[model samples]
Target: MSDAPSAPHLSRRVWIMIGAAAAIVTLSMGIRQAFGLFLAPLALDMGIDRQTFGLVVAIQNLLFGLAQPFVGALADRRGAGTIAVAGALIYALGLVVAGLASNALGLGLGLGVLTGAAMSGAAFVVVLGAVGKVVPAHKRTLAFGLVTAGGSLGQFLIVPLAQGLIDAFDWRVTLFVLAALVALVIPLALGVAGKPPAANHTDGPALKPALAEAFAHPSFWMLNFGFFVCGFQLAFVGFHLPAYLRDGGLSPSVGATALALIGLFNIAGSWLWGAWGSKRSKKGLLALLYALRGLSMIVFILVPLSPASALVFAAVSGFLWLGTLPLTNGLVAQIYGLRHLSALAGIVFLSHQVGAFLGAWLAGLTFDATGSYMLMWIVSIALALTAAVANLPIKEAPLVRSALPAE
Candidate 1:
């Protein structure tokens, strides 16, 4: 189902599809970001320590990463709309399984594997892939940022509500309620239910050649390496921040508020960053973003813990959070072209998820072993700086076909 060459205008249909994609992302990503708020209650109810819970959470992210490329390809071959709808159903099923489960193993099966795979089909990458296909190259990142911001908006809107629900009913019931809420993404997905635009003559060769070319390129590898840090910082912070704040003698409300602030600020940051990236060097911006994360972590750990500090940290961190996504994804499309954008983006995204797995798992193991999160925080800071350095070498230009040797 190649897209029609109809002079590429943002018509009513395009905006409608964009709105639908954004709505779906709002719930999928928002709920994922809210997982940290459940750690204490889930662990308490299940009689598990942070390490065990962390391992399962880590597994969830790991599975999500592993599944995404394949899922993205499926979305590419089939229609993103169908894949997204299927993902929503699976997401609901996964949540239901998690809610009904009483033990760690059962919860792991639900939350770690089922939910993770569901997210592969339903979450950020899938929606971004769809959004990329519809919008023209010039406006792609801006549109991607809109969907990215939708996820942030979801975090801002849902985390507080989830926290209140958890407070009122309990974790299990809250999850069930969320399951129902996620179902709404299904109808919205209908608007995105079609194929990518047809490949123009300038779009290069088919999938295998494009992939081989991407893999052979040094810039792609560099992109993958830097993206790992994004995953690590985000997953570690998202999953552990609430617990960290609680351990510092803050109330639950404070932790919840901090998370909400992150969501709130990211809504603005994602849009502004992508809008700015349209003109500036994306790689430079990425390096700066990573460096800021390191500095922010240092400041966060050095400063005494309090509501003000937590809120301020959330504001700063949130501004930098998830903003990398549109830039990175857009960069891939810029270098590789949109024909294989979904598959290539999925491959790069896997790096982030790998870091996510390590971040969550290691944070938990370190906490249980030493009863402190300091080691993980230090590791995060070092990785942030390293990623900043790594992004410096990326070349953002499109691949030069004539220069390549015969495949």
Candidate 2:
């Protein structure tokens, strides 16, 4: 609870910081949300099956996850501004390259490696670290929630826009346009310029100590495992749900609209849970979120397939989509302190991405082998339930008490 402001009012600088961070997250995450929309188009163009394209997206997810710790560590030592700018450029470049790519290696290099690395900078970890440094402790959870919502908003708004563009133009043209959108993050990074809160270096003996503490904690591992479910469920659904719907006789637009719904509802989910985390049990809320995910997926499976059923699924699933983010990030700030927020969060995110890789790749492999995503859906449900259990016994209080300077 360091740097909790006495008053409830937020300063102009804090507002600006939040706005810029959110904008960057919007561009970063918004564009990423559109990736699933391209899967079918790309597959048709390349003459590949779901598993082949799934491997590419899986590579992207894995690379994104793999790059986070290093990016977080860099942001901790350097500043988010530099990282954001680099991320923006690299991200833009990746899109341009992918738009022109003729083969799998080209797609993987452009989308999988470069853009994925860029996202670690432009998305949650970097933005939250920067915004968290400028905000008071009491409002930190709310801030994280609001910023997380920005990404959701981007997802909500961008998916439909991407679909529209795809309808009007080639996917190549759509990608180039998205690249232009990503480049906007560069100037915005200036608004977010600052080193990680000094407490990151001073509050603990050093970054190593904070890292050591987090790695050793059993709750940290639990959080990691639980978040893995989050990644798996999201990646599987995000990348494949549209195709799944296609198999069910739904049109591509149906898939686009469904993804958009998830984004729209998630806007509320992230904010509500974020606000709740400030006053409630973050772990408890996370447990509920995952349990609901399991229940919803089961219901979706049991129900008959139709436009109405799909939309309902989207609405409910979207609300649960990112509900875990704020709670998890808030829990990190609560337990570990904000000094190493990006670094620690990055490690947790890597776990999520690993799940993402497995989710995307496994779904593809299963569909290719069994001609259905039934196994993947079952696994997603099981993991969601397991995530609920994984989070139930977690301790959510601040863990680094020794280093805290006495009042």
Please, what's the RMSD in Å of model 2?
A: 3.3
lDDT against the true structure, per candidate, is: 0.86, 0.87
Give the local distance difference test score of model 1: 0.86
Q: Can you give the TM-score per candidate against the true fold?
A: 0.95, 0.95
Worst 10 residues of 2 by lDDT: 1-10
What is the per-residue lDDT of model 1 for residues 100-207, given as tens digits with 9 covering 90 to 100?
Answer: 998998889888898998988888777788788878788787777777888899999999999999999999998898999899889988878887676654665677
State the lDDT of candidate 2 residue by residue for 1-407, as single tens digits: 22322324789888888888888888899889899999888877887678888888898899889999889878977889999999999999999999999998888888888888889888888788777777777778888888898898999888999999988998899999999999999999988887665664444446787788898899999999998999999999998999999999999999999999999999888878777777778899899899999999999999999999999999999888987887898888778877778898999999999999999999999999999999999999999999999999998877745544432
Candidate that scores best on lDDT: 2
